[model samples]
Target: MSAAPRPADVVIIGAGQAGLAAGYHLRRAGADFVILDAQQVPGGAWQHAWPSLRLFSPAQYSSLPGRMMPIPAGGGYPDAAHVVAYLTDYEQRYRLPIIRPATVRTVRRAGARLAVESSAGTWHARIVVSATGTWWRPFVPHYPGMRDFRGEQVHTAGYRGPEPFHGRRVLVVGGGNSAAQILAELSQVAQTTWATLRPPRLLPDEVDGRALFDLATRRHRATLAGQHPVGAGGIADLGDIVAVAPVREARDRGALKAEPMFSRITTTGVAWADGSAAAFDAILWCTGFRPALAHLAPLRLRGPSGLIGTDGTRALAEPRLHLLGYGDWTGPASATLIGAGRTARQLAGEITAQL
Candidate 1:
């Protein structure tokens, strides 16, 4: 028999940047809440990023609410490990109530409260915060013969670096920043082909995450005002292919060139639109991810585009639920570390008022 469910005024279903931010505000409001994380350790998805991955934003811009990330050795952008350390420290510094190694399975409405069932146990809360970000749900699109392909295929979630791909023929797929960064590295040690729906667009070398966040904020505000967005740049404006040292080297070597996506994948490699084929040892799909919303499936709040309709961060259908750090739809730049804090603060205020 299972143990009796614990009770809380609020239950947050992720302990990453989003959840942590919410916890900061909930605590400040003196609301009773608990944060649950699936990962055994802290740092959220930062713990799983590739070895060389670095934040495009510096420490100041990458921090969560009430705490700044400790600047790294050279006062430059923090790498993956540095980020992990910062997140770990943030949780500790704040003394947030976080339960780890708890994999939430479902969230169901029970009476006037929500029952969050997880491996660790169960929690009943008056309000639920679904903050699980996109890292767990990598989305790889379908292509003909993909099932028949014998070559190794991996999504960016599983890709570490070029060491394992040394001397192999690699096809790096997608046009986003992750694709560009991975392709840039894979090209250095492996014979690589970058395939994209369209050519990749890169931001100016001087523009980094801070600039991108400003542009995104401007665009978001313009949209709200129904004005012609002068800050308009497509998705690529979000720190696309930061001209980092490695990426710059790759660019100079002509490794940044891209090809149109092929029609299908074959046993040996990919087949082109004109029925041409090229052999490859592997294919890396950096095609991005969907929000990790499976645990909230019981709530039935998601609609088209796999998003929960929201007024800001509060679910439209379920007023007691708030989704943080999913993307622009939830709040402007909420998926980013810096932006999550802003959304969390606002959402906490709303929740506090309602409660």
Candidate 2:
């Protein structure tokens, strides 16, 4: 027989950085809550990242409230494992009630209580924080003959490091950081080519909080701060903070060519928007991720887009429902841990006020 069901004041649908940050404040405020993470460990999104991954930023901005990420040697990036370890420690230190392997399948509001159904069972809470996060589902672009390929192909999520493609021709099929970072790293070892629909822009990881985020909170709050200083002679101000090594090298080599975006992905290779096809051994799709929330019903959402879209502190039509760490909707610093903490703290106050 299954154990008895536990009730709580709030049921956070995710236990990643966002939900964990939210829980930190919830616990501090003496709020009764439970964090339900789909994964077995606390490193929500990091678990799916490539093995050789490291924080683009210095470790200083990455650490959470109660714990510190151990500095890696030579001041390089911290790999995905380092993040996993740090988040594991954070959960233990806070004594947060995080239920593991409880991949939430559905959520709803019946009468005044919020109900969450997961692998573990059903949970009832007064409030629900849809922190399943913006990056719940990895997006794999549908292309012709994707399944007909006779070789090994995987999402960037499943990639480990350059060892897999050592001395091989590698084709990275996205323009985002995952595609960029991996492409740059793999280029040093293998013949790597990055395929994108648009001319990709590499962004600087160092986002200035005061100049970018806080500047918008109250003063120029409506506008995103530090969005590439004025007169910055670069593409969308991304070139300033980020140095595009591969693209520059490719530029000098006449190998870098961009289409209007990827149109299709055949098993052999990618087909461009102009109906051109390129063959390859493997293609890494870093298009992006979508949230898997189709199961959650009765929760009215205002998404013309396919997300629980919210501006951190703002409520949906449902007052009890809040969203955290959902891209730039929350705050300018939404993607960063510091921003998540600030947003979660505000949410704690909002929840307290409702209580």
Candidate 3:
């Protein structure tokens, strides 16, 4: 027989912002836990982000528990590198126990405990926190003739910079911040087309991640207080896109306008319902991602919506499993830096009580 699984009070299945935050709180609670990271290095998905990608919030606003991310020396929203550095430092500063390149294969019930099986080894724990975020699972919608397209196609996850697309005709799809930001930069060097399912909603210049986080916090507090606050929809009530500097500059240049999504893709380009067609050299799909939860498949906790029903972060079907940082369903804005810290604090407390 193989060696028996290691034992711990908790096993956090990610070392990204969410997992790190969970580790911080669990450590303070004095729980025995280990963080399993799929990536070989530190920084999580942030390390994979495009060099120019920036956090919409300033350093002070985007922070984890017990440590504040240092403000960028140039004094602006920190770039991906800055965030990566902060995360690297945060894990070291706290001495969070992390096992690298440990891709979790499955999480299943083992007697009264949950068994986490990963490349690094198996761990049996009383609780498992799934903080594996969505960056790994890029979502691309299907279109007729998509496979027939002759042009190069890339997703937000694959896009690095606009240097390669210079002088080429490029189609940028999706209407989220990624699409807008990427389009803004790519348009400068390439002939660009913006396509969206509907009109893109642009937030005023004053609105940003900080404001959105504050709104989410108030909404969360109101719900906890058992009060139904008016206009409780939170950030969704505002708009979709934040007017970052690059996007605003692009808008001023009349490059931010969006066209209706094409009905189908052709080998040459895309065609609209009206029969009009445009040819492009390449297509960039700024489409978003799905939660990276395949490792939890063995648990059979997902509902018809392909999501686990959760009472906050606690899975309804498996209370021993807590899903963190997937999105608001886990906790309002839990996918974000500040939000992860807040939610992890509560989650750690709950697990600590049981431990």
Using all chains and alpha carbons, the TM-scores for the candidates as numbered come to: 0.96, 0.82, 0.97
RMSD of 2: 4.3
Q: Count the backbone clashes (under 3 Å) in each candidate.
A: 0, 6, 0
Candidate 3 structure quality by residue, lDDT tens digits, 160-233: 99999999999999999999999999999999999999899889998899888788877877887898953576
Which residue runs does candidate 3 get wrong by more than 4 Å? 224-229
**Reference-based lDDT, each prediction:** 0.89, 0.69, 0.93
Measured by TM-score, how close is model 1 to the native structure? Answer: 0.96
Q: lDDT winner among the candidates?
A: 3
Could you give candidate 2's per-residue lDDT for residues 1-355 as a string of tens digits?
A: 8655557788888888888889999899898889888887678888877776656544665666656667866665577888878788888888899888898887787677877888988888888887876455678877777788755676876777778788876677776656666776777777767777668754443442333444334432433463543433323443422333443454455444444555666777667767787777776676777655565556767577655555455555667777777655665465566667777888899898877
Candidate 3 at 106: error in angstroms?
0.5
**TM-score between model 2 and native:** 0.82
Q: Between the candidate structures 2 and 3, which one is better when assessed by lDDT?
A: 3
lDDT of 1: 0.89
The parts of candidate 2 lying over 4 Å away from their true place are: 1-5, 145-148, 203-220, 223-235, 240-267, 271-277, 300-302, 309-311
Q: Rank the candidates by TM-score, best first.
A: 3, 1, 2
